[model samples]
Target: MQLNWDSTEELRQAIHTYIDFYNNHRIKMGLKRQLWNIVL
Candidate 1:
């Protein structure tokens, strides 16, 4: 997919926001394996 952003900072901020949401609120079956592996 193509991500269109106004500037580098915008893209950076968007990526940070996605990362925060994924880490904090997103639950995945793979997360159990990740936890065991300490991948996060």
Candidate 2:
């Protein structure tokens, strides 16, 4: 993926959003449909 951000805050926000999705919204088939934070 190619991303262009004007400032550090924008990059930080993008990373935070991706992490939130990965931890809270994404499903893990290998873990039997559970979120990452729940497993942690």
Candidate 3:
């Protein structure tokens, strides 16, 4: 996949969004768990 960002902030935000989804919302089938589990 190829992506072009207009600015550094846009690229940072995109990475942050992906990390948030990976840690919180995305489920890892191999691990059978979220990458990061938060208890609050």
Q: Give all candidates' CA lDDT scores.
A: 0.82, 0.77, 0.73
Sort by lDDT, top down from the best: 1, 2, 3
Clashing pairs in 1: none
Pairwise TM-score winner, candidates 2 and 3: 3
- The candidate that wins on lDDT is 1
RMSD of 3: 7.6
Q: Which residue runs of candidate 2 sit more than 4 Å off their true CA positions? A: 26-40
lDDT string, candidate 3, 1-40, tens digits: 9899999999999999999888764445534444334331
- Clash counts for the predictions, in order: 0, 0, 0
- The C-alpha TM-scores of every prediction are 0.53, 0.55, 0.57
Give one digit per residue, the lDDT tens place, for model 2 in 1-40. 9778999999999999999888764445536644565877
By TM-score: ranked, best first: 3, 2, 1
* TM-score for candidate 3, residues paired by index: 0.57
**Candidate 1 C-alpha lDDT tens digits along 1-40:** 9868999999999999999888766566567768979965
